[model samples]
Target: MTQHRPDTLSHAPLGRESAYPEHYDAGLLYPIPRAVNRAPLGIEEGALPFVGEDEWHAFEVSWLNAHGKPIVAVARFRLPAQSPHLIESKSWKLYLNGFNQTRFESRQAVVDTLLRDLAHAAGAPVAVELLDVDDAALAVTRLPGECLDDLDIEVTDYTPRAEHLAVGEEIVEETLHSHLLKSNCPVTGQPDWGSVLIRYRGPKLDREGLLRYLIGYRQHQDFHEHCVEHIFTDLMARARPERLLVLARYVRRGGLDISPWRATPGERPPEPLRLSRQ
Candidate 1:
């Protein structure tokens, strides 16, 4: 195992150069290596080295073969949280494009097969929608909220780090912010940029410690959702707050901006709001 030093920002390089270009085809689908399938869990539940929700990013998506010619098929899909299989989004995107040169008997067949594959990977049923040009308007919705640009917070540094926090305090309110923003595709290492927000209620958290830990991910490689989950779990253990929420709004990549939210059972996430750069 390699130990990451706080001062060594360059120690862990991000996956940037591998980012796929916008015009890349979507027919070339592939699977993640079995070795990398290790569940990104820590030594124990709520441990500091927590695995975030963004690790499940995947899409085996594609469009129908209109006119028997390969064209980009706009697709929208939703995976159930109950699924055991989690598709890596970067891999999904690549997988979808892998089909650009391939042929399908019908759009329904394509959709059905994709649903089965994604469901298997997610360990739950998945839904997919093929969008026509007219349906583009309804295909995607903008996230809810004010832009995060110009939304600045005081930065501080703290120490005495532990692997996790023990649950104790009943958090009434809290705010966590980080400016260490960088975006990179899981497969191509292309940069996907954005900001993150964490709010909860419980005991008073070490503001400086939280900020330092958030900044520590400056060079870390992972998806937006995964990053937020990692933060949420880490704080849950370290701060042991009563209620917690994690939200991450990433900048647009390939005409799409992904924001993921997760909380304890019965917890609700705020509506997706647009941030400044969004």
Candidate 2:
């Protein structure tokens, strides 16, 4: 596959400041082509190897109900990984802000608008659900896996080093996670912190080396989805796992949080769980 670099997203509203929209305007949404990053990773368009979704949570979602009374609620959006584009974070914030003052006859009206706009921007059918702000399902929970944060290892370089990944002779199936996963936004250079969960069945991965490999991403610059995909790809190349699943739950920023996961065919996806730091 021919490799291509990601386009400079200087025109996007990611690192720039702009006035928020006062009314419902779908034009506020900006779509970044997923191919820009996938190409460099050797992933071809329309032939993704994983089945997953980018799950987004918006906490500041609100709008005016019938009679212009304020209605507040949280929103969850799920976009398939095969989507041609992913909505830029800042632009998504601005797009959602447009509903702040807009009046809708019912909750369904707001949901319909969100579904239509997000699905169009993502270039795939999106699932949008509005939940009460205090919904019990939104409670914070711990990642279900053997935590790797306590591993004592010396790290000199922060740049991603895929060579650090290795596997042992023993075959095993296990789940491992770490809260140290972090990367910068390619356009904004802002830090994005998240917890990563890895589940696989194959040659036992070197736990120390795995932690070192993840820590190396501390200074990497990429989008949340791309970072997760990079980790998945690197592990596949090094460990050659029979079954693999990589999921990252990033902390919320600008009133929204993004969690992306990639898994091999027939692998079960993890449950939607909010991390403590999210």
Candidate 3:
């Protein structure tokens, strides 16, 4: 059950060559049911142990203004954790490309449309913001808390093993990060490089074991959101932490990057950051 349920992730667009559209087509967006992956993790949708949103950054958005002038800007989308669906990445890129030749009255109009379409697809009220290219704060932010990679350890297995999570006797609150989180895309089998940040308040997790668990994902294959949820679920099941937050930054693929944040209900994540490799 390490991978997504077959029937849950079925889509014609994925694992296929991209055929970009030249006009606006909300139909280009593909939605995958989240329940498929949650089921394997024993996560009941309503009784989820975490609360957070999936943050998406679109860096190659361009369209026409009212005067047929070209308009370009970066987009930030926040899809709540409660959302029943997660938009497929390839489909998302295709949907955004459809706007390349389309016309909009203003940037707000584009944002409004995105909010509507994405929310409709995700089955939740997704927040969307359009930022100017020169906006000082971009996705280039760094991970918060502490760097777990600072530990010197040995690595042998790349296979994901939840059993490696060992905890100390003391209760603690800390944020740990690692840049070795690597997983392949389920569709294309292409490598997805990511830096993960784990924050929790509970028994102190053994730094060495945590680092090994991250490295275990090296050969894992799945979508970014699913991978993060799997990590959260694995930690919760094994360590039984009182509170947890799993945030991951995957390098851009197709000019888009997805950062998924999942935390205990009503928890806010640390400030945004960009790892050196990102």
Point out where model 2 deviates above 4 Å. 1-8
Top-TM-score structure, candidate number: 2
Best-to-worst lDDT order = 2, 3, 1
Predict model 3's lDDT versus the native.
0.85
Residue 25 local lDDT, model 2: 83
C-alpha lDDT of candidate 2 relative to the true structure: 0.89
> Order of candidates by TM-score, top first?
2, 3, 1
As for lDDT, the candidate ahead, 2 or 3, is 2
Q: For each candidate in the order shown, give its overall lDDT on alpha carbons.
A: 0.51, 0.89, 0.85
lDDT tens digits, residues 1-278, model 2? Answer: 11112244767777887898888788777788989899888999889978888999999999999998999999999999999998888888988898999999999999999999888878899999999988987988888879999988998989888899988899999999999998998877889999999999999999999999999899999999999899998998889999999999999999999999999988866665987788
Candidate 1 lowest-lDDT run of ten: 28-37
- Position 143, candidate 2: lDDT: 86
TM-score of each: 0.59, 0.96, 0.93
* lDDT, candidate 3, at 18: 69
Which pairs clash in model 3? 51-263, 141-273, 141-274, 142-273, 142-274
Candidate topping lDDT: 2
